[model samples]
Target: MSRVATRPVTLPNGLQLQTGERCVADLGRMVDPTVYKNPEQFDGYRFVRMRGTPGLDAQAHLVSTSPEHIGFGHGKHACPGRFFAGNELKIALAHIIMKYDWQLTPGYKHRWEEYGFGWSSDGMAKLLMKRRDSPEMDIDNF
Candidate 1:
């Protein structure tokens, strides 16, 4: 996970853009509703409606939000290790949640670092966790 940069660098137009970013694309921004019925909701099942349909190759597919899912980054610079990292993170977090009773302090603080155009966890608020005997909290919940 990344955090928004706190420092401000000058822009060509002298306008300040927030350093943090978010996904800005959706069906309305690309596909037409005459084709996509109700195009606004994030329906995980939306793809189910187009199962066996054909005739869509590269250019047509380019208009889709499917394969280019940016959660894995984009283009040649995209992470090459994402698949491994994803599984590892999932396994690790699952193990921790299943084996420990962890809670944030009522008033907690965090630190971060920024370099180049990126920011990362500062290692502060490392975590407060301990093993739990009860099996009530399932790792699957994580």
Candidate 2:
């Protein structure tokens, strides 16, 4: 969280204020309908579409965090390890998908808990996976 303050002043709204600590929250801006289409729905391809543009492509990558995405932060303050983290995630996901057949356990449901400033899921769902290298997978097929 970033802290900011305003010098003593009053104007348009006639609201008065003195210099004080302010916690700037960016999540609301991230999902604002004015800034994003279908803000309430998850669009995995949002950045992918933006990447089609020339200049924007450079900043649309997962690790290139900006004001539009504070997950890794923005500018020089952005997380330096984001590149390594993104690559590791991709490699892990690729290996998992290539090596196993998996599914969530029956009757499982997703749930999240709201903390003061964030939300977290317990991820209680169980996954049943089987190796894909068994007799069911014919080696000669490749």
Candidate 3:
């Protein structure tokens, strides 16, 4: 999120925020290796594992948000539709995985490039997908 500083302020870490300057928060920085192990790599069950930890059960849920997990934002600014969005994504992914096989296009390599608060993958990146012969579960019942 971007905010314009109303007055100069010095952060606890000593970073200066100048008046009228636009400051953008990089959400990705919040989940850095300092906060997560092997953060640079993808792990589908990462949160599932975190949820199993004693104190993290509720905090690790898909729609749960805190200062550490801000996907749906935190506090009063949190998205009201986060719960609906999370369930929709799960249903969509379940159907997609049941009906099709998909993978990155052969020999395609892409990395996220960041410019200010914007990040993008290779513009030409593509995915290869094909219908599956049999779905593990009936998606129609969903």
Candidate 4:
């Protein structure tokens, strides 16, 4: 006789049915279908200025975060290292944007290789950047 094994499902509040790795919640189900219509389009600001559903926490400021966006992982078992990672990413991006003009070099091509389900761009790729001469780009009467 052959033995059959089955995996147990996890509940929302961190109740594990069967012992295993951290819960793998389906992050996609929590997204609002209306705002994320045709989610494959990849609109970066899709969740900006969104309001919480009526009767939910009236003060819930969910502007930047949505269940649809899994950049920071999800649920109770979410990445414990995310707080540090978030701050680091923001600081690095701010420094880069404030210090230099970032753009892809002309005629440069980006090649990628797939690892697991994700792909990563290969090589240094040679970004072209230049320092800004003006202190303020938008303000003229400074």
The superposed Cα distance between candidate 4 and the true structure at residue 110, in angstroms, equals 5.1
Model 1 ranges off by over 4 Å: 1-73, 111-115, 136-142
Q: What's the CA error at residue 89 for candidate 2, in Å?
A: 1.6
Q: What global local distance difference test value does model 4 have?
A: 0.54
Task: Judging by TM-score against the true structure, name the best candidate.
Answer: 3
Model 3 spans with C-alpha error above 4 angstroms: 3-21, 26-29, 118-120
**What TM-score fits each model?**
0.38, 0.64, 0.77, 0.49
Pairs of colliding residues, candidate 2: none
lDDT of each: 0.54, 0.73, 0.82, 0.54
Worst 10 residues of 2 by lDDT: 133-142
C-alpha lDDT of residue 76 in model 4: 63
Model 1, range 109-142, lDDT digits (tens) per residue?
Answer: 7556764344456655546788877755676565
Name the candidate, 2 or 4, with the larger lDDT value: 2
Q: In angstroms, how far off is 130's CA in candidate 3?
A: 0.7
Candidate 4 local lDDT, 1-142, one digit each (tens): 1112246765667765653444344545444565356654556554442344553332223222335555555466456777677777776666667667878889887777764444557667888888777532333333
Clashes of each: 0, 0, 0, 0
Q: What lDDT tens digits, residue by residue, belong to model 3 across residues 22-80?
A: 87656874557877788766788988998889987878789998777777888898899
What's the lDDT of the predicted structure labeled candidate 2?
0.73
Instruction: Put down candidate 2 lDDT per residue, 1-142, tens digits, no spaces.
Output: 6555667756467866568845455677577787677866779998898899776786678788767778888778889999999999887776677778988887778676776566666556588998886544343356
RMSD of every candidate to native, in Å, equals 11.8, 6.4, 3.6, 8.1
Question: Where is model 4 more than 4 Å wrong at Cα?
Answer: 1-35, 38-42, 49-67, 109-112, 121-124, 134-142
